[model samples]
Target: MFTLFKRSIVLILLGLLWENASRFSSINPAFCPPFTEVLQAWWELAVSGDLWVEFSASIRRSLAGFSLALLIGIPLGLLIGWYPLVRDLLNPTFEVFRNTARLALLPVFILFLGIGEISKITIVFYACIIPILLNTIAAVKSVDLLLIKSARSMNVSSFKLFLKVIFPASIPSIFTGIRMAGTGCILVLIAAEMVGAREGLGFLITYSQFNFQIAEMYAGILTISALGLIVNQGLILLEQRFSRWKQLPK
Candidate 1:
């Protein structure tokens, strides 16, 4: 409780500093509104349920894309990592594809999928897949060979050996991948939505900018930042729960 209070106080101070800087500076208020103004705009939008509707749409798109990426990437990565032949056959292609920036394909996605949820979700999925696939592959490959050998010597079945030994060893890496993918999902979703979204934080930001609602634009940006922070913290909590045996140093 004390820690939370201290953090809140620090944040409040920082906000005050920012508000003063923006208010006094010759900088255009249209570009950077005072913190108090942004907060007031945020409060108004929240009360109207407008912010909630946008937030919900953004969250739904991000999660759907993220989930699909995980489902496809993890199994394929595990297979490629575990089997040399599979790795040899797929690694070059996978590396090439991963190197191809998802944003670069935005035009293609828009052309093919249209400026709708399909295009936005496709971009998010593409952005999310790389981290998940790479992490899963690395995790499987990094499993201690000695542990596998010991399990084999003990007459442990192949399936059981993977379930009991490899999976446990790879969990940390898996969590790292998940966290990375989650961030990627948020980024891609926002960018995609900004292009042509009817409802989302991105849309709100764009619309506010066009209408010269500078404070509302800043408020939308703040809301997106808050959402990203919440997602990251949730992932951290999940990682801690799953990897409790690997405790951090005090």
Candidate 2:
């Protein structure tokens, strides 16, 4: 908690500046409201349940896409890293897709899949998979050779070796990938939602902007920022849980 507060001090200072600046600046209040006014707007949305409803929609899409990426990326990456044949066959395809801008393909998805939940979720999944897959592959390949040899000297089965030695050693790197992909999931999801959605935090932002509800738009942006922070922090906690072994005395 102390660390979190320490990290937030600068942000709090900035918020205070923003609140005071709007109060005294010559700029139009409609274009740049006080931070407190934005908070009030956020509170109003929350009380009216609009914020919660949109938050629910956004979270659901993000979770679905991110989960799919995790399930597929980890195993596929493991196979690609451990087996040269799989790597040879899949790396080219992965590179081709990864190099393409996800948003650029959004038009194609919408053309075939339409501007529905499926297209938005698909885009998020596609955007998330690359980082997780690439990171998992690197993690597996980077496992300690000494550890592998030590396990081999014990005559451990391949599966047992992977489970007991390789996987645990790769946990840190895997989580790094997860964090990257997790944050990317939100960015891509917001873009997807903004492009075509009736409801979501992204849609709320767009709608508020179109209606010139500046405070509400700012409120939506803040909500998305908070959501991204929560997702990243949650992943960090999970990573720490899996890495408690690192805390053991040398």
Best by lDDT: 2
Q: What TM-score does structure 2 among the candidates reach? A: 0.96
| TM-score for each of the candidates | 0.94, 0.96
lDDT of 2: 0.92
Give the Cα-based TM-score of candidate 1 against the true structure: 0.94
lDDT of 2 by residue, 77-181 (tens): 888987799999999999999899978998999999999889988898998888998888999999989999999999999999988988888889989999999
Clashing pairs in 1: none
Q: Give the range of the ten consecutive residues with the poorest summed lDDT in model 2.
A: 20-29
For every candidate in turn, the CA RMSD to the true structure comes to 2.0, 1.3
Model 1 local distance difference test score = 0.89
Q: Worst ten-residue run, lDDT, model 1?
A: 25-34
Model 1: residue 175 alpha-carbon error in angstroms: 0.9
